[model samples]
Target: MAKSNNNNRNMSVEEAGKKGGEKVSEKYNQEHFEEIGQKGGEKTSEKYNQKHFEDIGQKGGETTSQKKDKEFYQEIGKKGGETTSEKHGEEFYEDIGQKGGNRSRGGRSNR
Candidate 1:
């Protein structure tokens, strides 16, 4: 018989696994983690509305522009465009362009 971790006590593999699993569950319950994540997301959403989100995004873009040159953005944009084009057909771009043209035809009046 093999000696277990507990002094000179002997334990089976099944018993050891069961004991470790129970200890892990007691230490970190899955539900508790999910509850915290939901609460944080709710708080963030409450603070950052649509317009505020746009402003924050613009500021981040400005900072990134200062840090990186045009080539960096162009390369990233090329990769993103390639990925999107692969995922979506050409018609998707055409449809969105038509919608954008329609929306912009009247300038801010349409907005």
Candidate 2:
């Protein structure tokens, strides 16, 4: 128990929570977190429909976009693009471009 003040013998709620969280972290590994996250996501999905998710997503996106500037978006976009390029290589973009071209030309690909 971590004491918040020198005068008090009791631990603060924040300090107790931190101590518990540290203990839990020491006991659990990455797989435990992933398993719990998957279960939680499944339960959330069962409780919420597509519309609920879409609405929340839209609200979150709107709020985030309002808070962030063009430069911030550009920086994140560049980082995401770099990560994707590294993961998928240049051929991934070529394949997507081909698919887009095919769709634009009424499923008739030039290639």
Best by lDDT: 2
List the pairs of residues colliding in candidate 2.
none
lDDT of 2 by residue, 54-98 (tens): 999999999999999999999999999989988997788989999
Q: What are the runs in model 1 whose C-alpha is more than 4 Å off?
A: 1-39, 97-111
Estimate the TM-score for candidate 2: 0.83
Give the distance in Å from residue 20's predicted Cα in candidate 2 to where it truly belongs: 1.2
Off by over 4 Å in 2: 1-8
| Collision count of model 2 | 0
Question: By summed lDDT, which 10 consecutive residues of candidate 1 come out lowest?
Answer: 102-111
Give lDDT per model, in order: 0.86, 0.92
lDDT of 1 by residue, 6-86 (tens): 887987888878888898779988998898899999999998888988999999999998999989989999999999999
- Of candidate 2, the 10-residue stretch with the lowest lDDT total is 1-10
Over the full model, what C-alpha lDDT does candidate 2 score relative to the true structure? Answer: 0.92
